[model samples]
Target: MLAPFTPGATAFGLAHVLAGALVLVSLMMLYQDRLPALVNVLALHAALLGIAVGWQAWLQRAPELYITAAIAIGFKAVAIPLALHRIIERLDIHREVETVGGISLTMLAGIGLVALSLLVMLRTAAQADALAREDLALALSVILIGMLMMVTRRNAVSQIAGFMMLENGLILAAAGAEGMPLVVEISVAFSILIAFIVIGVFLFRIRERFDTVDSAALDAFRGELQ
Candidate 1:
């Protein structure tokens, strides 16, 4: 009975499992307390997202999406994390993440967010492909968890990590869609590159001016100068 399914079907099943792993890693990001550790987890998330996208390309027989996956892995998974790690080391900023609540509480909220996403997406996409619906659900969880990190943490670097994680989710969602335009995918990939350069420069400037990357402190400094 199991032999009836084609190789593509097996591959698709594996891809779904891998994409689901990305959501799990994103949840783990909410658990990390150290800056370096958080960055490491984010790198893993991005890499997993890249692989999932590549799997989608294979499933759909879309060569263009392979390029998209390469872009995702090259930048988000590798370059961004390396640059951010260097910034943290060179700037000598606080290495511990300052969170609004305990890690356990954050984890609970993330779980709730995942459940909410599942309920919403399943109901909303009843007519859609099961894999696509699953993709959206996991993607939404990643995006929400990223938002949670940004809102709860004080460190600007951590916030940037959150933002990248959010983008990772968006990429996953786009990749899972079969007929997403090639130009749109390329444009999205280009935007990630541009964002990385802009954010990198901004972080260096911020570190120079304030000698710290705390969002709360940066706001205070702006107010004082104003």
Candidate 2:
């Protein structure tokens, strides 16, 4: 008979801390109006994700997850943030991000989303392992917060950061699930890379044509074209 998987207190505690940090970083991203600072926080978010995934790999004895962690750290943490910094410099975008709602209101909404995720996931995944259940709840919170950021921010760069944050949450959920395929993780990582490339192209095009990367400007242009 196969042995049931069980983790030590230390392992579970560390995983919880890392996952909580990721969600906290998402909340921090919500209040940041400066693009450069937001990108820095995004990098920190990815780094925490990588560390969390690595911890999961150690706990699950899943060697494949280490690769996923590596990809998260290398691409999302280092490469993506550096590329974004260069883009900001090249585009000369220095204005504070224009948001659709007040920071305090958005933060309250984020808190509500976290509470909703925890309540729903805990009830839904009652039969699952405790660590995995908690991870899923926090992951959902991060995903919801990312969506909130995307809808509330007007800057294209901030929207892109939000999208990436959502993807990180997906990866966290996958990492927590048993027997998640390495191939699936790799595919998702590559898809994100391709999307980043396409979005970067669009950002330059938008800036060149309209001289602004605020999404509201795109909306106005579309209105004029109509």
Candidate 3:
């Protein structure tokens, strides 16, 4: 069995900083209108996750976590973002993201979600390790914020980014938990890869049929067919 986690002050501080940074990046994604800029932010978010996982590996002495970190940085942070950039350029989709609600309202909702997550997680995980409890709370906030982004954005690409962000939150939680098998991490990574491929193809097909990547347009077309 794994030893009890009793991280020193510096380790806890670094962990808190990394977790907080992920939440901040998620918030940043909320108001981003430009697709390219949003992609860049997503890349940053993934890179931070990689770093955070690496830190967790060091703290937990789980060498397998290093592979998780490498996959996160190499694929999610670098390759995926580069692929998105190419997709945007190939599709010539340079328009600002179409949001369903006012930015102020969406941001307020995001803040509320964060507060709720913190309250709920802290209360429920009270007996857990301090660092794990905090990470779980912050990860929940990121997940909620990502869902908010998905609902508030009309553009398909933005929704895809939000989906990826939600997955990142899951990764954060997994990394925080002790004794999480490497196989579980590998499975999640492969699932994300498969999802990305399917979504990429779906995007191209949508563009081909509708001449736009706006999900709202697809909904309108469905309504017309009805």
Q: Which candidate ranks first by lDDT, i.e. highest?
A: 2
lDDT of 1 by residue, 1-226 (tens): 4468688678768877987898899889988888888889988988898899888888888888887787778877798888778777766774565657888998999999999998999899888998788888888888898888877776767778787888788888888877788634563665566476537655554443253467778778778645
TM-score of 1: 0.85
What is candidate 2's lDDT per residue for 1-226, written digit by digit as tens? Answer: 9666655877898999999999999999999988899999999999999999999999998988888888889878998888778777767776655656788999999999999999999999999999989999999999999999888876667877888889889889989887777735563666477466636645654332243467788778778644
List ranges where model 1 is wrong by over 4 Å: 1-3, 182-226
The candidate, 2 or 3, that scores higher on lDDT is 2
Model 3 segments beyond 4 Å from truth? 1-7, 182-199, 207-226
Better of 1 and 3 by TM-score: 3
Clashes of each: 0, 0, 0
Clashing pairs in 3: none
TM, every model: 0.85, 0.85, 0.85
Q: Which run of 10 residues does model 2 get worst, by summed lDDT?
A: 204-213
| Count of backbone collisions in candidate 1 | 0
lDDT: worst 10-residue window of model 3: 204-213
